[model samples]
Target: MSLDSISLEAIRKELLDKFKDEKITNIIQTKKYKIIMEVKPNNFLVLNGINKKRDTFYIHISIDPSSMEIYFSESKNTEETISSPFLNLLQNHLIGGKILDIKQPDFDRILHFIIQPYLKFGQTQNQILIIEFMGKHGNMILLKENTMIEGSIKLVDSNINRYREILPGKFYISPPSQNKLNPLNVNRKDFFNIFYSLKDKSLNLWKLIQNNFIGISLQNAKEMVLQANLSLEKDVSNASQADLEMLWTSFNRIINNIKNHIFQPTIFLDPLSEKIKAYSLINSIQFPPCHKRNFKDANSCLESLFTELEKEREILSIQNKLDQILSKNMLKINNKINDYQKKLEEVKNCEKYKINGELIKANLASIKRGDTEIKVINYYSPRQEDITIPLNHKLTALENARLYFKKYKKTKDSWEIILEQLNNNQLKLAQLAEFHKLYKQYSNSLPNLLKIYNDLMKLGLSKKIIVPLKKQEKKKNKLLPAKYISQDGWEIYVGKNNHQNDFLTFKLASGNDIWLHPKNIQGAHVIIKNRGNKQSPPLETLIQAANLAAYFSKAKKENKVLVDYTLKKYVKKPKNAKPGMAIYSQEKSLLIKINLPEIKNMISQNSQGKILSP
Candidate 1:
């Protein structure tokens, strides 16, 4: 869920409490969506401004989006960011400045950080970093003297938006106001006047409240109705005096929390999927009973939630790309098959041409010059049926027969070549179909996805997936696997990509080591270190390794997953096989449900022999 206005207010207060008056030692735009600043006393503050469909609202201070950072994180994927002039200017103007104050304008999901520039013996110059978290309209703009635009991360012109144009040298303007009443500023008389003024019968109680209130969202408005012991579907005219009293009390209670800065940052998780579902500044009592975890502040909650969400989104994005390629290739194959079938139908009458040629030669004397046709008996026909042979009047009879014979030969030869080409294309289509099935079945497995992408690149099937030589070299240099230390101190390694799977299985693992993978499912290749003990891992260790295999597979969200485990000695990599493809024997299957939190806790206890991070 996006951060609502109440949450943004809570976050702005939290930032002021933590970072007020801190010197900005450095400023770097790690990416267009992210900005990193190093502060005095060793603090890294991140301003993530990604404004995409799935990721609509995130304006918080965190480390980076990829890592699980308790404090802050500097991004390691800086090479992906293109250097821009706007970023350079931000770095030059903001570095060595001190944050004087932070403000969230009227709980509008906007933040302005007032910075005092460092100058030698001069009056303080105030600059502002305005962060607007208004869904697709979200942007970060830097302003000088709070009026003139310095630069913006994104520039909007009259072509993009006529209401507001965010460009350099255009006097900065705040977004147009909705003219809704601020819940905190509304008096009891004015609050009641809202419902009294409403004459639209279609406006329900929930809409009435949300439309009148400045910061209340639809969900929050629903919560307000529940708190007031009233139905959200209740019409505004149906509210009794007692109901109005309850509604007024409830509205004040909720708004008072935001006004007084008493935010209890809460995140709701889906128990079945073990993924975060929603977050809010206040507890959501109207929601169904689920796992609710509260954080000390809003930023910490936002960071933790967005980081995990970003991981899932990244996997989904790659899956979508591969799906598109598969769909296009499937269409191409179907069209080719259709065209070839039509060609085959057209060539089915090649023998008729030969018959015409032979009959014309035998009955040449019957044909005269300037004749368009010749009536003759087809000797080649089983019944000696009379046929009208078409004649090329311009050519001699013998030449006309020769022309038919040449046409017959050419059509017969093309049929043979077309049949051969069709067979080859059919074979290719089958291979692609199999890969498409695997891709759909194991969309969440990064290793499987990378292997499929690599195969598509080699086959020239993917038009968008470009594998640069430098990236290939970099991947070769770093073959990091998902490493976890078991309670028995045995190191367990799980492959995250195709090459890592091959390296872990063939080179790093010993013959006696245990290999685990999801049964008949695309997943990571997991290896449990035996250390020449030549014996099976303990049951607990084996289960942990098996769980990793299932957790990293496409079946991660399933209630129960079956994982197959066997000795590495029984596993064999076929010659010229695709990456991460192997056959094995002497395997045992284990059916179990994976508990993500339990596994995460177990892995977090160990600090050594972990290769998941660079």
Candidate 2:
């Protein structure tokens, strides 16, 4: 469910207090409808904090319908956020600003963030950012202090909502008001009078209170009913005067909590599905049995809630998009390859056409002028025998022979070109397909998935979702090939993706080191170090490295796989080839098979996401 005004009120307070001395350092539009603003302390000396605490945190604003929220996150998700004109406008005006004040006008689902621009030489400007949490009709608008619209995340013209048009230069207007009474501001007699006027005898407190009051959601209403020591099924008309007064007292108690700024933010998760179901600042008796986690504040609660959910969402989203890109492009390449091969086969018959032309020319004069067929002795034939030759009666034998020669020339000229095209397309298809398989193997891994995303882009595919190549590599967490220790004390490494495979083969392994790969199959390039200690690696080490190759390959599931092994010097990367691609000669093939559980044990020695020492 979306957040209600009550939760927004608590969030507004938390953010306002936290931003007392923080200033905006950077702002990024993290998605099509989301914006993240980085906030840092004015004093930067104590900038480092252990664990979840940080000197700098980000405020995430997502106008997305599913998880629309504005909250603080301890870390920024470097996953590619979109760049839009609206995002650019926001950065220009607000990157160097500080939060002057945060207000929730009328306790509605709308928030107004008043920003004070960085102080220049005796000059200052102020801007107000208004964001609404209304589902589907949600909007984020930036306005001048005088309420002129500067820009908006979503533009609502007259056709969509005639009452308000959120266009640039227009007056900024609040959404139409909900005519409900503010329970906090109203006296007890006034609140009771409104409840007494309800005509429906069967109206329950949870639904009816939510319908008639501002800043109260059905979740909040349910809690109010329970806090009153009233049944959720209690009807308005059935309540006596004493019951009404008791309920009013209960309602006043909750209002006092809000006035006193007491909020207990907690998220409830379903024990079975393990997914977050509901979050509450006020406890509810109506909720089913749930596993609950409490937070010190609303921002931390929201961060954990939305971050976990968004990570799952983003992984699935990019995985599906990458699948589509790879599938469509690979199919196109495959079709081109098939056409080239088919044409190559047709062109192989060019020699037959030339032979027929030679036979026709050898007996050109023996053919009658109007004859449709003729028997001729072909000198070039191994058995100098007479052969029947087809004649085009409308043309001379010389003309027919010339036509055959022309056909032979065209096909012969294209054979080599077609074969070369076929080889190139075949190589591209192999690379894309190999990465697609790698994506499935590590779908939950963000760094590897992003690296795969960048690799696919290099292969000449375009799409909106992209992660820059350099972001995947960090100073303290450099990407490396999978490593394993051989039982004989040899160090073996296996490449996980094309870039790492190229690095492992060309940069890390030396000339005398042993190399292994799945023969004729797309898989990891495996290298065994410790070459200086021995002329050849032990049989046990070779077997383990071969199994590692097969495990990280397409043929992993098969009971047995053919693996090629040679000296690292013999395995050469082709000129201008794809990253993982290589050519090798003087290699021996081994039919390798190993226990799956055993190979995984050898790989567990090197955790992929382990932090590197500085």
Candidate 3:
């Protein structure tokens, strides 16, 4: 949720107080939408306004559209930061600068940082950095002393916003004024009169208050409804005198809080979704038991809320991309499978051509070259049924028989080849489905996501997932499968991706080893190493390996799961098959009532610290 002007006002006051004794030390561009300014306390008299090591903090300004905010955080994480042209220009003018003053023009969602840069021995200079927190139109611009635009993080021309353009060499203009009445100045009489002056009384009271007030958001309006205990959906026309008085009292209370600076800086979280339900400098009320967090200042409150939001956004973006790539490739594969099946049906008619050829051969003496049709009986059918055959009158009966035999031979040959191709496509589709399950088990993981992204690149299904040149060499090494050890000390390995599965099944496993998998489910391939024992592993060892398979499958959450186990020698990779595809025989199924807690503990104890947790 984006901050309203009220919350921003509180944040501005909170930051201005802390920054009075501080100066900017550095400016870091953390991500596409966020920047960090390292600030610390300064001793202007002793060190030419250079900052000391004490009282250092970061001013984090974010313009992510979803959460446009500027707040002070205790520490800065420069791990993901990279340099940009704008960042370098900002550092040149902003570093070592002290905020001489901060302004909120017309009490809008904007901040003007008037800064004095570290100058030469006798010269003086100042710069203005304007940050606007308008949702979906947020921006940061550096301006000259006279408000001439120097640069901006985002560019808008006449086509984007005709009233004003933000570009280099243009005079910086303020945003258009929202000519709503200031809530801080409204009295009870003015409030009632304003409501009555609007001829349309059919408006909802909650929306009416928001439409007529400056710096008040929808959350503010909803909070008024809760505090006044009035009907939340009541229209102005339906409201009694008592309801209007209650709303006036509720509205007056929040305005007084703003005037007195009695802020709560609260974040209310929905219990079910565990996400921020509402954020304001004033307390919020929500239904079904919300978790309320109160902070000493608005800056801390916003920092905590948006950190969770940013993480959620990053994961969602990756997931949507994975879905898009898979959807495109899966659709292509399904179309091929459909076409092959249709061709198979046409070739299945080869038996009829063979029957016609045999019947013509049996009746060759009775048929003449001028005959157009013939019926033969007492031949191929046990009951001697008659079969009608259409003939080419210009050709001899013997020649017609030869043509039929040739057509039968050609169709039968095509049937064998196309059947193999169709089977391979079906097997590849199944392998992809299994790989999707493994991917979801670590959807929030960066390493797993990159590994899967690399896998897709190899399969030629994803070209848009870019890998940096620096990491290209490291990506050449394949990701190892998840490894574990059984109670009997047999090493077990589970493959998290198709390539890893192929390596585990054929390259790493011995012919006498035991293999286990979840039955009819998308999951990992697990192998229990025999380690040259040359004998069968105990039943308990088999169960432990089977448990690993069930835990990693799509059915991991089920109370009861079925697992299939077989010898490695029985598994054979089909010709022209995908990396993970295999045909196996002599398999046995294990029905398990899963002990989820036990399985989790076992994983933590035996997994060799390689499980990629989401």
The best candidate in terms of TM-score = 3
Poorly placed runs, candidate 1 (over 4 Å):
25-79, 83-85, 120-124, 136-138, 153-173, 185-203, 269-276, 291-293, 309-319, 348-412, 445-451, 466-614
Worst 10 residues of 2 by lDDT: 605-614
RMSD of each: 9.6, 6.9, 7.5
* Model 3: per-residue Cα lDDT over 124-188, one tens digit each: 65789998988788889999898888888888999999998999999999888787877877888
Which residue pairs in candidate 2 have backbone atoms (N, alpha carbon, C) closer than 3 angstroms, thus clashing?
none
lDDT tens digits by residue: candidate 1, 244-326: 88988888898888788877777888877767777777767876666877888777776677666765665677778787888
Q: Which residue ranges in model 2 land beyond 4 Å of their true spot?
A: 21-58, 62-67, 73-100, 114-128, 141-160, 165-173, 179-294, 304-317, 341-348, 375-388, 463-480, 483-493, 504-547, 553-593, 597-614
TM-score of each: 0.67, 0.68, 0.69
The local distance difference test score of each candidate is 0.76, 0.80, 0.79
- Rank the models by lDDT, top first: 2, 3, 1
lDDT for 495 (candidate 1):
85
Model 2: residue 609 alpha-carbon error in angstroms: 9.4
Clashing pairs in 1: 63-72, 63-73
TM-score of model 1 vs. true structure: 0.67
Candidate numbers sorted by TM-score from highest down: 3, 2, 1
